[model samples]
Target: MSINLQKGQKIDLTKGSGGLSRIMVGLGWDEAQPAPQQSSGGFFGLFKSHSQQQIQDIDCDASAILLNANGKLYGREANDCCVYFGNLTHKSGAIRHQGDNLTGAGEGDDEQIMVDLNRVPADVAKIVFVVNIYDANVRGQHFGMIQNAFIRLVNLENNAEICKFNLSENYYGMTGMVVGEIYRYNREWKFNAIGQPVKEASRLQLLLNMYA
Candidate 1:
């Protein structure tokens, strides 16, 4: 069974299992339904004006950053060590991003990042998970419009879910969210649910602020 975690809660990654070496972090969300359009009628309100503009999908990008014990990023470049759409894998080959999902459509995990716990370097302490809208401010979109936002960690060995966290709170006017974090605790791995919001223009800026 999977464990559902609450905000600010933390759980051991290998509570009862020690052979777990590979894990997957999955993030998923749904595009908000468009609001009802207003009618501009003419000729005794017989005909209503309509727009030809097409509705775009919500492009929420998922990213991960490997930070050290001092809360600092190992690589200075954005794509060098950070794993995301542009840079799919880390230099050490410990972490890798599956791919970019242009739309938050269909069901299940829209994006996934695989982590080899044993492959990760000793200097790397934490893995921070983040999600942000592609062109939020310019397109007038935010987390308030998204629904069913969630992040989960699964054990790849047995295909069993370890824990999951869902953002159920209202986050109006927020462009990005630091969904969760996986860090080392006394030589054991643990996860923290941090549904914190950010207003940065891009994911790079948000990460800089996080490690700064």
Candidate 2:
């Protein structure tokens, strides 16, 4: 019973049921197919047409930013609070990011992040999941060249999908996206579908500054 969430929708992850101890956050995306370039061959009849050569894989990197009770990062200097490709797991061991081209998870998920809700620290209030294109500026790439981008939450115990958020809007100039957030609410964990795009950012660090 998976629910397709709309942007800005919020849902309870652990409620009524005893509590969800483990869950997986899966993200997926594909490079938009370039238009078929069927140029009419002139006198020489030489034509170069279509796909692979034009659209290279857009390296979309996803990261989780851990925020404290006040919804703020530890500090601008405390970089260890963030878990990304460089830092696969947090010191608390509550969150583990399976990043770095680990697309074998299937179901079109390019990357996945596992969370032990029960192990999260008390002071930590939220885990913001963000995705950005690596070296987008240098590569001249943006979300506009991306397609089928989505984020989903799965209950590991039964392999049931809790909810999914699809970023189906036009992101012509966006280089980054704020996919979603998992935060504590009255001692319970909840998920917020924040499918918002960020402009002019070519790296994940810039998106983090939103909280700092």
Question: Using TM-score as the measure, which candidate wins?
Answer: 1
TM-score of 1: 0.89
What is the alpha-carbon lDDT of model 2 when measured against the actual structure? 0.82
lDDT of each: 0.83, 0.82
Compared with the true structure, what per-residue lDDT tens digits does model 2 show for residues 1-212?
Answer: 99999999999999875668899999898876565445643211222333224434568888889998887885344445688898898887988998687322334788889999998888889999999888888867788887889999999998899999999999987899999999989999999999989996787779877887
> In candidate 2, how many Å is residue 153 off?
0.5
Which portions of model 1 miss their true places by more than 4 Å? 39-54, 201-203
Worst 10 residues of 2 by lDDT: 42-51
Q: Please write out the lDDT profile of model 1 over residues 1-212, one tens digit for every residue.
A: 88999999998885667677899999999976644455554222223356534345668999998788888886667764478888899888889999999998989999999999988888889999999988876666678788899999999998899889999998777889999998999988889999988876344566557675
Please report the TM-score between candidate 2 and the true structure: 0.88
lDDT of 2 at 111: 88
